[model samples]
Target: MTEPQHILVLGGGEDQLPAYHEARRLGYRVIGVDRRPDALGAAASDLFLCMTTRAPDRIAAMVGHLDVAAVISPASDAAQESVAELSRLLGTPYQPAPDAVRASVDKGWFHTVLDRLGLPGYAYAQSSDEAELRRAAADLPLPVIVKPSDSSGSKGVQVVADPAALPGALAEARRHSFTGEVIVEEMLLGRHLSAEAFLRGSTLATIAVTERSTTGAPHMITTAHTVPAELTPSTEIRLRSMIMDICGELGHTDGPVNFDFVVDAADEIRFIEMGARLGGNGMPLLVRHAFGINTYEAALRLALGQPTELTPRHHRKTALRILTADTDGVLLGVDGTDAVRALPETVELQLFAEPGSRVHRYTQAGHKLGYLLLVADTHDALRAAQARAESLLRFRIEPATPRAASAAAPRSEELTEQIR
Candidate 1:
């Protein structure tokens, strides 16, 4: 009898859970590692290693100790490098070159490479100084976007409509960035869509396109995502072609890839960014529900150099709506969760915070209180279920206590001088 393959899943964010589940479902002995001892995915793995994913030696040692057949990371920038480094140490064929992964991690380099390839997309400039930022703001069109070159989940991203706000936006960008470099780009107006793909060597397989709904103002965090992007067949075909070409250029042979884009009023597709991992917010689960394809399984299979099954078994509508708190304070309570869970289309309701947990003001996706997954036969049904879920949701938070203002005390020297 042959021994079962062992797979190592790095980190345990909401996005990494599906990979762990699918690997186990496929009969692979899975191990999950994270810096946090209480990470969610740790509960589901065969072995849980609480350690730093950035430590390549530790990871390599763990992989060897467990005899892991493959190392996989989902929706993590740091883990991507860790996987590459571990693969190099283990003599595995599963990872892209470190330089190629670096190009994807650094937004400035990604844009430069795409531009050099004459890819169809918006123009972008990287600024590390105030003068350069001001110049870029002057040259770029109004309603431009400023964000950190290496950040994800929409952090440090601001849409500036006026030149006067550029300085403050630049400061905010620098505040969230470790590299001290920000990217300024021309804002393209269009319907946002995400296409997920799996690659094997030079061959590419398109999974499904999802329509994304994001917060419009102060934040660009994704609020909802619906599968089977509401696009005509021709547009979907074009978007898939673009994704395949981009992945090929990036040398992404195996594993999951998500490409985000905007469909302009002219029906043209503009590339935004691509992550070399699974989509977050239960997107992988939603895709499985809609298409009868398991992206998580495909990714593990590819990483193990095994054959993958890429056929879609069904066509349905599925959506994930993130529950966000409207205010910042200690979470007093969450109401109507049981009622929401009773809905027919409600697949899962997950809350990240406890009653006494301190919940900050919702700014980015990271601040979301929880998420609701819904599946239905049609887009209207899915939207209706999401609405019902929202109606049943309630968050009670205490108002934040304001800091006391310091009282100004008169100085004795100033008073004596005035008297003199």
Candidate 2:
């Protein structure tokens, strides 16, 4: 009897569970990796390794003896470079090179690439030193955005509308950065949008743009995303073309690429960042629901060096409502979940927090409590369903006192169980 070929999966979180399930369904042995032992996806895999996916060489060295055929880091930006490196080491056919992955993750490097390609130029500066960051921010216009150079899920992001808040924002950004580096950019004001697309040979096979809603101001965390974003035909076409051009220039014209962009007041596409991997926050689910295609399976096939099709069978309006808290507290309970789930348009509902789990203010994507997925026959229907669901779902939290808050800070493992 022949041994089953091992497929290395870099993350074993809830968001990464689909990839693991897909790999197993495709008759491949899954080797899941994560730093936490209690990862939800770990139980789903044939084998699980308690280790960080961020270190490529280390992972390769540890798992080299296994019959690993292909490697993938689904729904994670932090582990992408490792996926590329492991692919190279294992002789897999992952399209992105290590340098390209690094460029995609490193905001500073990607901004430079945009400038070199003569794309839309947004004034930005980056540095690890406080003095240098301050000096750079001084040159840019006020009301800038400050964030870690290489972090995701909107972690440590701050909008500095006031000059007095710049220092505090910088400190917050630096605190989240693994390298202590931060990027400050002049705020691009307009409709915040995101796209999920798959590329095959410099051409996009499938794409979907979403209208993004965020918690306003200081910490702009995503709250909801509605697919088939309300846009004129010309605007949609231009945005698609712009994304294609940017992907081609970045040398990420081969697999799944998720993008964050803004359609500014001048109707210009302000490209924010791109990830050479599947997007988190139920992006694949949204794509699947709206486009009648499975990007997760497409991404899996890409990792396996197999051809995958992305032709949409049908189109439908879909919306995702991210569940969040209004204030920092321990989750006492969530009411009306049954009522919300009973709605006709409610397709899926997930609750990440238990009664006693600590939940925080909606400051970043990582702070999400849960999400509601809805589908409808028309735009109006979708909007109505979204509103109805929001009103139906109520979160009861016991607000933490100042001293208790510091002492009872939620551990990463706990949050990983609840949020990620």
- Give me the candidate number with maximum TM-score: 2
In model 1, residue pairs whose N, Cα or C atoms come closer than 3 Å (at least 3 residues apart or on different chains), thus clashing, are none
Q: TM-score of predicted model 1? A: 0.87
lDDT of 2 by residue, 1-420 (tens): 776798899988767888998888888999999988977767888888888998888888877887887898877888887888788888887657554597668998888877877778798989999888889888988889999999988999999988889999999999999889999998999999999888898898998899998887888888889999988788888878877767766777688888888888778877888888888888898988888899888898988889997999889899988888877888878878899999989888988778997888787887778878999998899989888888777787766767645656655333222221
Q: What digit string (tens of lDDT, one per residue) describes model 1 on residues 170-265? A: 889888776788888888888987777666666666577888888875557788888878888898777767666676677766667777788988
Q: Which stretches of candidate 1 lie above 4 Å from their native place?
A: 1-6, 25-31, 42-51, 61-64, 97-100, 399-420
312, model 2: CA deviation in Å?
A: 0.7
Q: Candidate 2: worst 10 consecutive residues by lDDT?
A: 411-420
At residue 228, candidate 1 shows an lDDT of 78
